[model samples]
Target: MREWHADYLDACNRHDLDAIRSFLSPSVRRAHLPSGSDAWIDDLAELFTAFPDWRWRRVQLIAEEDRLAVHLRAGGTHAAAFRGIAPTRRHVNVAEFAMYRVMDRRIAEYSGTGDHIELLAQLHGGLPT
Candidate 1:
């Protein structure tokens, strides 16, 4: 399961929704950030649609009983439209973190965070202050 976390990242990097979906349990529930802003991830296709070039790199994962905490640097060039914004063609890197709870060899829950302020700044062609 520890390696599967890495596999997920690789699949995400490739923007392969099918591969990413292969990792989900039927009961899979993923959260973008822990504050409960979103109820659930309906499908993997939408996940990749939102993050066209999402790549998780410099990953440090800790695997423990029933859970895995993954720390990563997520980045990509914005080549595709997202969130109603035109493509920025911008290379944005952000320090992102996530924790996954796996049950029965499939991810059951996930929570995550990142420097949104910095990402926005980069997207606007401004360096983070």
Candidate 2:
């Protein structure tokens, strides 16, 4: 399972959606906590469209039973509009944490939280003075 997480992280960094999808089960469910968005795959595809170079580097991975948690840093250049925010074309890095439930050696569900406030502040030119 550790190796699976490692490979998953690598796939994400490489933007290899094929590989990423291979590890996901048909019933997979994923959520972005900050935005309260739930999506299976289309949202992810849109994200990659917005940040073509977006990548996640795993800081740590922990697993207990069928649940796995990953700590990572996510960053990329803001090249397109996202979440109703126009592109600022700025590079942003934010900390993120995700938990996944594995069923039958595939990811069945995932929920993740990221530093969206910091990300938005960076996008909007460092918040209000």
Question: How well does each candidate superpose onto the true structure, as a TM-score?
Answer: 0.73, 0.81
* lDDT (tens digit, per residue) of candidate 2 on 16-89: 77787777786676664322113445566777877899988889889999999989888888899977888878
RMSD of 2: 3.7
CA lDDT of every candidate: 0.65, 0.76
Best by lDDT: 2
What shift in Å separates residue 21 of candidate 2 from its native position after superposition? Answer: 1.4
Per-model root-mean-square deviation over C-alphas: 4.0, 3.7
Give the range of the ten consecutive residues with the poorest summed lDDT in model 2.
32-41
Candidate 2 local lDDT, residue 88: 78
Instruction: Score candidate 1 by TM-score against the native.
Output: 0.73
Q: Which candidate comes out best when scored by TM-score?
A: 2
